[model samples]
Target: MRSEDALANIDVAVLAGGLGTRIRGVLGDTPKVLAPIAGRAFLGHLLDYLSAYGSRRVVLCLGHLADRVTAWLARGDSAGTIDVVCQIEPRPLGTAGALGYVRKELRSGTVLVMNGDTFLDADLRAFVASHRLSGAEASVLCVTVDDASRFGRVEIGPDSRIRRFLEKAPGSGTINAGVYLFSAAFVDRFIAAGAVSLEADVLETLPPGTLNAHIAKARFLDIGTPESLAAAASVIAGRES
Candidate 1:
């Protein structure tokens, strides 16, 4: 199915709850999602991108400076093409826990979740179509980067089933892009099982063939560090142009 069609039934979730300790020196008290990029808040750019794909609604799981982010949303920072909602974490919940915190607000059977600080320039239509075709309970977006030391490696079999997740180490390898598609049922299961870290507590524990891998050779941007954050404006401008 085309992304627009698939997205009509799939809500997008942005995980913006990280402490962003690495970039704190530059941003001060601003939430990482509200960091300025290309003359606009990074969250605005992200919402514009999602709006292009006709995403219906976006549920932002916010922590760290949740109030600031929420205040920005109230100011109409979103692109106005999609409905945006905030789910503030009472306390810091790991990635999986944050999702569980907003479980009641998600209206879709499947949800597309991605990190607020990372952007993957890929065809959402293809990604969504592949996931729907595979019938996997969960699917992860993976990309091969020159240095896997920053992000852990993901091993997928020839069948595209995720086999294992290796801890971050010095090497060039395929790594999770921090974007995932999950069935509501699987998410509920994880919440029930008390899964915390999405990677370690849930993904790593899943059987070898349980997760599908949607590998793409796309430009990946992560604004988690000073260097990367500095480069985001250019990357985002390039994408927009």
Candidate 2:
């Protein structure tokens, strides 16, 4: 099915609250999401992309320098509807932990979660639709990278269900594209368990086949480091030209 048709029911959550220490050298005091890529902030482009994928509502998870992000979104510019929520961490809670902090705001039947540090060209609307139809508790967006050792690699069974989630394993395999679709039930589970890391804490408790993996077909770029950020700028520049 077409992505737009599938994603009509999903709400988007952009994870933008990290400290982004890795890229601080180039983006000092600036939240990674607010870092410029091409001629606009990276978060702006992400919002535009999500809107194109049929997202009607977007919730941004903000932490350090969150006010800048809030101001940027408040300016508007036809990038869909946006809501910014601060996710201050008393201590570093990791990925899933930060998400747990905002459980009250996630009221959608299906939620699409994306990392603010990366740019993925996957059809999120279609990804959401596939998750809803699969009857899985959660669906993760994945991509096959030449080097999977730097990120979490997901192994899928013949049934198309997630069998294993390996963190930073060497060699070629499918790695988490920093995106996901979670059912309302799964979100409830997080609230119940008080978990931290989504892969290590929450997903580990789920029964096998409960988590689904969807492979992305487009190029994926992670702008977490100074070098990668420069590359991202180049990519964005090329796109705009």
The worst-scoring run of ten residues by lDDT in candidate 1 lies at: 1-10
Residue-wise C-alpha lDDT for candidate 2, range 39-108, written one tens digit per residue: 7889878876776666677667777788777677667743655444445556566678777877677778
Task: Give one digit per residue, the lDDT tens place, for model 1 in 42-144.
Answer: 9999988888777879999998899999888898878887889889999999999999999988889899999999987777777888798899999999999
Clash pairs, candidate 2, are none
Q: What are the root-mean-square deviations of the candidates from the true structure over C-alphas?
A: 1.1, 2.3
User: Cα lDDT of all candidates, in order?
Assistant: 0.90, 0.76
Q: Which stretches of candidate 1 lie over 4 Å from their true place?
A: none
